[model samples]
Target: MSEKKFQTVQLTLEQSVESRTKLIQGAINRAAHTAGVVSLAGKGVYVIDGLLMKSGVTLDVQAGVTLMGSGNEDKYHHRPGPFELLRNQTPICALIFGNQCDNCVISGKGTISGNYRCFIKANQEQAAHIESHHYPRPEMIYLQDSRNVTVEGLTIIDSPFWTIHLAGCQQVKLANLTINNEVRMPNTDGIDLDRCQYVVVQGCKISTGDDGICLKCTEETKRFGDCTDIEVTDCQIHSQSAAFKVGSSSFGNFLSVKVVRLLIVNSNRGLAFQLRDGGLARNFQFSDVKISTRDFSEEWWGNAEPIYITFVARDHETVIKPDDGIENVQFSNINANSPTGALIYSDVAGRIKNIRFVQTQLWITTEVGKMRHYDLRPSEKRQSLIMPVSGLVGRVKQNQQAGLSVMYRSNEDQPD
Candidate 1:
């Protein structure tokens, strides 16, 4: 028997919010049944509550097409549910969401606008952003419990929260995507992979209010196995927080993480391993990264540390397995222009092991000279301490060790 042809449908959107939502939903639902493709074409802005992607479906947002959020809370009641990693509990919404789907792709050189300014509170001039405490702040894109997914070549902008969050997925590939949010929007991480496996992110440029590319193991999704075999490379990242961070939200062990050749444009912090939840990580490697960091505002999470590693429990009430720790992490050929240096600390001794740096150069600029405070945020009660600037600081036990090799510190006074 001959194979049935794949259905290919193209849509032009310029209608009421309700009409456009139904049109796109109908097109996707029909196309998904036939393993087909649905393209959102034309120059008009498409107002959507959400786009539900199913298995065997491809959403090709063509160039010049714009998918804009409706900015109405009631239109978004159709979302599957919250991912629950978000700190905000006001309302859970997403512009594009897929759950339990396989063989799906979202690509093209179009734009997805979150319309984030609508969610920001008015009449506030703080350097850091304060989101609306009472309104729904939806993510731009969220996919969970899916396999064989691919996203590429899209420009995602102005997100009120995390730009793209993939959770509990397998065999995902993200490439050549761009995320540029308002630099002060809170928690608008460019890409967050949670409890995911075999993911590759490459050739992307991200700038946001939080970590540019982050991996986490959330408390709600700890039932999944270790996050393993993830790679991020050839990306340019800038953020008010760390350019690349692994978990201030970790609740599961992470394994085989490789991040390389990232150009951090300007960040508040550069590289960090924040294991406040006691989840261990191993076999993580970072290399050939160039970073620029500066202290921006007190509302953010970091204080310009080029590399910060802390493996500490949140509080006395936090539970930690006896063997829960981070180890076998390495950073090589790192170059940074920042005010502060590396901070290696733990709540107790010997929790962080085998941390190493090779051929790292930190040019401590005099722009923000002599920062006298240390930050241990996302922790319990202990926010910061009055400390002096040093090239490197750490907490090491007598038996266990962390190593440093060929580190160069440069400033005006210290010529050598």
Candidate 2:
């Protein structure tokens, strides 16, 4: 790795405790033009109201420098009226935001604390008011329309919402990040890549209440382009939801994606591909993945399945115009132990085709408890087609049938 010298500035907030937020933001603003490093030194607690990073700046929190959020909702700024029709429809005011910036980095062996629990009462009350407007929760880091970004070696804790959100970004790299949010904190996804391309996430340890590492393409993101050419490898993930997922918001294509060498433990679901919206999710590859899934409450999205791939309308009532379905996916060297087996379901109009599972060992531990079988059901009154599964090591256990369950529903056929 080549090293580049950076003009550095050290910030001390102990002297002016009352103006700590202003001092930090001003330092970052000054560093943007100089391509400099703003180092938060010493063991002082620097409470930041919010930070909007400029291009070509590096916020380096040195060891023992703790940047804590003020935890005051009034201090944060929300994006005005019009909101994007994506997951987390509520526009959140974030702790650190990078908007359409380039060549930025947030790195160092320090802590960025969200202090999320301090607003539990407020979050609960806001949630209770269902008819009211969407509440503005604060994410730890929200980078939108940015390029050439790198976030490395940060210990992020107690995030209020999606911990690291990358929207409409390109050529981003996230490595060696240790993100630990409270298990009870809802919607605290570890790393969310929304309509991001040419991204690489590796050597990260993420444990959160929601999905660990997820790729989403919403309607707003689709306007930019498809999310393509992403890679995630060598990560330890534990989540109440799926450890690694493509989408619950797939409005655009997810192409040329790859995930390898993942250790997923104690997650609700191991791997999931949810293509509800009209999109094409294809040319995906997953290899050398070891997964352990357990049952969680229904309030969560998954059911402890080792692998799940489904295609359905976004809503049952609304009609979803099916585009190119999920196709040309490959999973190899996957060893999973779960209460439920793999589920690959596709509707009649959109079929999941050419799915190959090579050297995959999925052991359903029914002795632990009564578990559900692999469900391959299409929509109502639709003929279900059986796509071939090659090199499947484990059997689908349902109705005492042990081996493979590759059967098609024929309109003219009745069992003899």
Stretches > 4 Å off in candidate 2: 1-18, 81-89, 122-136, 316-319, 367-416
Tens-digit lDDT track of model 2 for 1-416: 22433544455765453387777777888787677778777776677787888888898888888888888756765554223454445556788888887999999999999887765654454341112123446878988889999999999998877899888999999999999987666778899999999999999999988889999986766556888999999999999888998877777889999999999988988988876665788899999999888876655677777788777666554245445578888888888776556776755443677777777776655433233433322233332333333212133212122322323222234122
List the candidate 1 regions with Cα displacement exceeding 4 Å: 1-14, 77-91, 125-127, 366-371, 397-416
Give the number of colliding residue pairs in candidate 2.
Answer: 0
* Per-model TM values vs. the true structure: 0.91, 0.83
> Candidate 1's residue-wise lDDT over 1-416, tens digit each?
23323443444554777777787788788877777778877776777787788887888888988888877756663443334443433336677888887989899899999988778778767646666655346778788889999999999998888889888999999999999899888889999899999999999999898889888987676666668899999999999988998888777888999999989877988988888888888888999998888888888888888888888777766678888887888888888777777788888777887777777777775433355676888888587755667677677543122334223345555422
- Candidate closest to the true structure, highest TM-score: 1
